[model samples]
Target chain A: MSEEHAVPAARLRTRGLHLAYGDASIIEDMNLCFPDAQVTAIVGPNGCGKSTLLAGLARLHAPRGGAVLLDGKDIHRLPTREVARRVALLPQDTQAPEGMTVSELIRFGRQPHQGWLRQWSDEDRDIVAHALAVADLQQLAQRSLDSMSGGQRQRAWIAMAIAQQTPLLLLDEPTSALDLGHQLEVFELIRRQAHTGTTVIMVVHDLASACRFADNLVAMHAGRVIAQGPPDRIITPELIRELYGVECTLLADPVTGTPILAGVRRA
Target chain B: MTNAGSTRAGLGVTFCGAGIALAIVCLASLLIGAGNTGADLALATLLGQSSNEEARFVVYELRLPRMLMGLAAGAALGVAGALLQAVTRNPLAEPGLLGVSAGSGLAVAIAIALGSSATTLRISVAQLGALAGCLCVLAAARTRGVGSDPIRLVLAGAAFSGLLFALTSLLLLLDQRTADEIRFWLVGSIAGRSMDQVTAILPSMALAAVLILLVIRSLAALALGERTAVGLGHRPELVRLTVVVAVALLVGATTAVAGPIAFIGLVVPFAARALAGSDIRRALWLCLPLGPLTVIGADILSRVVVQPSELPLGVLTAMLGAPVLVAVVRANRLPSL
Candidate 1:
């Protein structure tokens, strides 16, 4: 409970961020500040630019205009390695190189902290150990990623990001490929990590799960943010209908009191 | 249980094992040639027990330079293959299949046809041609469908290689003396190449080695995927361009001295990955010893396989490497980068 209220007010802001691929602009004039140390879920229909916005925030895609600010400093102005030290991103569909063990994969997270003469150190070892513990993957540290189940592999990837020790983490549909049980496992882990003071932003397809797991929600349609607030405040029937072009019942989950969507139909 | 520390330590052991094997092969290369001098006489000559002038000449002048050439060429091809594979993120990507060495061979043929005999000049021209060829195959691979599908990229490379080989053959037909001087070279051999030829490619090799060191970590990050690599603070485009330049230098240097030795580039890196795992960083290090081991071993076998004359090193390597190439393709799950 003490850690729950201990969220640091580290700020990540975007000012009129614009993202494009060739001539097609995906996200245009985006302006927002991520809730510090809270799990923020960006939910949207297919190709609504949620993922593009995530990539822009993580500095994976250069913005066509404006800028992303980490702690009020323009992210683009910082050296790439310096930015990596502050932000870690887990893109969907990452494939570990053949025969890479979980621990070996996690070691790559330390790259920004290391150089030719500083390949590894006591701090790196400690951080990797802590990451494995946090992900509950200590037993699987030596196991090859190929030998793991989907849930286990997903956890391993998250552990790599955690080992990066960045204050901000961005995941693009991290649980997209998992089974229901595995998805819950990943979501719970993500929640627990966010509770520990790392600001988490994820692109989520499941609006119900977003409501259940995220503290703040950003709903988008057609490359623009349509609503942003607590999930309970923002996830209304009208919002659901507008985002998904579907009619649905909006009710609270009896167990958690978060909004839930049911009886969906094409609008 | 193999943790991060154990894996790093494991790579060190693999490197040492490959080094030992390389040393043994280098000794064998020095000892067992087609010359009348027996292994015992060669060993005696090596130990300075008997100062036979013929034995000294054969061992020091003849066998030694060939051994050095094989070592350098093997390492170059091995590292070049690893770098190319990583840049493409396709385990099957190789310079030989992708027309790099063929391009170098064609450049050398053109140089000879144009009446340029300066050994240093030939190496530079070959390197420039190799850079062009590497860039060409990479561009073809990047075209929409070919980038994701490994086999299609190889097909594109093979088609490009065929075109280059055809052009080289046309050059062979264009002139007789140039053809005579370049024919054996086109087939690829480590035989009778002077130490000067080995020395001539040194700067290029050193340049390649330096570039590889600079980019190894970024290349490893790249195996995770481009966006992931970029997120790790690496400039994927810059890393890829640097790797292409390094591959060009190494392959160009190898082709200039050994004459387009096929499959060494394919086989050496493949074997290194098998031993050292797929981290391009670790695999590149293991390639150092494994490359020389493969080339020197093949060179030794080449001398004995055809007694009076000798098999071309390229032919021997191709004979050994073709099966490996087939096996890599036939593997149920191609190792995804």
Candidate 2:
């Protein structure tokens, strides 16, 4: 078994982690490191604990064993508000209260910094403005989240996560409910954020999208890491069969020169 | 341009209609009474002097305070309900729904049973109970594996309320006087209450005000969901904790003065939404008038329905609130708080 202790962390690191929901154990004895300012994707089959792992790392789920380290310190020990300043998370199934405007949703990203006394500071306003500009949300700031198209709403949510202004962002299938174009809009934004020194870790189901976007890929099967490396190194037929139970040939995508899952027959 | 104008105009009409209802209710609360007093007689007493000390005393001192109590208590309960629903992202998540009211009731019931002055310490003790109830419910909501299901949260609240009610009942049973006091209080109403009761709950109401100002922003953030709340550097746990405490203080104090008036919190917010749309700030604003109108209207109805005997405010509220609860459930989708 390859232990991840040797991997260096720029922002977030998970050490010897375990988790469960009631009687059922979801993940056990897992160790992983998410480097800063890069895109890392965890891709695995449906029941492989991919979302669980993401949630655990974000402190949404407490681990029965081990710790998730943020900024080389234990994330669990940090106040939720304090940790939020450094890391933001986008959940897979996001729900907003009806009639929540895009700007209203993004403005929530400033909650930790705001209080009864310090509610309307200039810094708060400037940051929200900056986030809107970055997400191209200035035009639709007043539009309700419920009123927007799928792609626009997804953008609005991503704008909210970005407004969190954390160096590290963890997204669990942020594109699950989006169409292809909407998916691209969100992925490109995630990529742009990554390029600008924000560390991003996402759980994606599509191997091609994962290969195209992620600089680092972690593949898991039945709650164990089967492979972790660049897409080129981990795209073998056997690895695909182990992770996805799919029998497919891997070819280089001509456009992006990333690994593409092309197929023949079953294993 | 014309279509948008009509939508805005439609909203304007709704708001104006609510305002007119509010004005009429406020004036009518002062006008209508179960006693020998009438609007003309009350007005004569209000103008300066009256031949009968009894009418003057009832009009100026007794009914006025009670009406004010209804207004303030209803207002506070409505806002508390609106805020809790907004933050929990569940429309059913009212202070009373979450057992905060029961918590206050149980504590006060115990106090009264111990031969303590229930009327004197009504506000403080009730607030303390509310705080306990609020904390327990929110802590349970925050615990792992309790994802954002609207029904489950309400269920948890029901269990919490049931536990507190059981405790209250047990305490009330222990002493006859306490049972008398608790029984009178538990039915949830605002009738024949004195100005002293209103004075007792004011400090906590003030404290709740401060907390409300602090909580609204975080609550709006919370409506997005937890991961987002945390990512925004908001301590979701801390915000939840504050919300629990604030809800308890406000609801507890209101319950203390009014004796567990039910459904104002639920129906007021529901009415506020139909009038103001879904923006939390607007919903809260509309709740201020709608809440008092409902309580005072119910209080008036309670008086007139059976001339000499008044209906419990709780009964009246339940009557008003039941249809709302049904509507909430029958909607194509339950609106998130």
Candidate 3:
């Protein structure tokens, strides 16, 4: 709760965004505002369209009826590279070419800012170095991604996103496959990134971790936002039952004072 | 930071070493041959020391042009292989194996069957065939289950190649007058080909080179999966289309001159990736040298192996490349691109 707050600006927002895969509508008439320089987590159960919304926000998925606005203009209408400069996304399935060093992978983040004639500038080098440091991966810069452990590999991926230096970062289940320690390693890194005034939006699977890490939570079910606010204000037994069909007691973290779900049972 | 610098320096050293090796191979290609002229005589002729007329003719007219063609064809096939593998994200995706070479070969066979002997027209026909083949391979790669499985995609390509080769053979059977020419060309050799044929395809190769330079960075981004590439501000569709066209041009040009040399495309990029790792930019640089080295080395071996009757350049490359292909497939795991 002691994290310093920046003047929040809703640079990214959806106006009646409708997304579908052919005839199957995933997210319909979705309206949401993602606060700048803050960490917001989208948490929902299976088939809830959280990832679809993330894709729409990142412009990977086109809106069916409405629009995703970036800085008051339709995101789809802006030049791709121009949108890329302002937003970066780390999708759930991240794979790098074999034998790619951490630094080489991170250097890809600077592609948007580079051109055919202007490659590997001093500025690009500096930003990559800064990203490595920020992700605590300086020592592993030359190490291949395949050689690293799970936590270190995830950090390297995060470092690549950091090197983009975009104001908004969206991650889909960044800690999905990692162990608890590695999960913390990534969550802390995301927190540090948010502290530096980058808007961090991620689709998190674990409600407890989402409550602990995200400043705001958007809970969804069947392509609808059932609840949206701070975790402490929006989380309740009824909301938990609605989202996951589980009834649980909400407890408080002893030190951080964040909401923690305990004693859960199937509704 | 220092580690990165050291790696960069190491790459430079490796690149220079490959370049020197390619130069040696080029020299060997020029020196050793199936004729009466020996390496010493060819060297003397090259240095303008001896006026041996036979050595001069063999070196200048026969060996020199063949070596140049080998270099150009080798580089093109090597680069084409690397580009194909990178874009398809499949290590086994090769010009020869994936029907691209066969595509061009069939085009030329069709041309030869129709009684067309013009060199420029043949090159254009071959390129057009290569473009078609390239599109077919990409289409197979985009299919639901086939695209995700590298081996399945290769299987599809092999089937397509077999069909094309059968069609080419059928054409040869139907046309007896063009049969000898088509048969000789079908075996794939660089002997007796002139410098003019090599020069004819230069414009297309040059254009392909320009396209590659433009998309090299984007292609590298593509190796990280499509969504990530899109997230990085690159148009993955555009990059894929450009790479397919570039691969077609390179493979088509090489086939036009070399009669569908196989396995150099596969082996050269494999070795380059081994030496330079998987970064396409670095692997591509190594491919430039390694490709020519492999082709020229094979060409030299082909000359000395059979003496009076030289081995076909295509046959020699297949002999060399097939084992590497087996080795790669037999490895514990196919290295993911």
Highest lDDT scorer: 3
Give the CAPRI class of candidate 1. Answer: medium
- TM-score ranking from best to worst? 3, 1, 2
Give the clashing pairs for model 3.
none
Q: TM per model?
A: 0.96, 0.83, 0.97
lDDT of 3 by residue, B1-337 (tens): 2222127777798889999998989998889988899989999999999999999999999999999988898899999999999989999999999999999999999998888989999888999999999999999999999887888988999999999999998998898977898888877777888989889889988999999998898899989989998899999989999998999888888888778999887898888888788889988998998888888888889988988878998888888888988898888998899
Scored by lDDT, model 1 comes in at: 0.88
Interface Cα root-mean-square deviation for all models: 1.9, 3.5, 2.8
Best by TM-score: 3
Q: Give the CA lDDT, 0 to 100, for residue A121 in model 3.
A: 94
Candidate 2 wrongly placed segments (more than 4 Å): A1-9, A15-32, A63-66, A222-226, B1-27, B49-52, B83-88, B94-114, B121-184, B276-282, B305-312
**Residue B148 lDDT in candidate 2:** 62
lDDT of 1 by residue, A104-154 (tens): 889889999999888789999999999999999999998999899999999
Q: B271-325, model 1: which lDDT tens digit per residue?
A: 7787778788878888889888898899999999989678888899899999998
TM-score of 2: 0.83
The residue-by-residue lDDT of candidate 3 on A44-134, one tens digit each, is 9989999999999999999998999999899999999998899998989999878788999899999888886777899999999999999
In CAPRI terms, model 2 is classed as acceptable
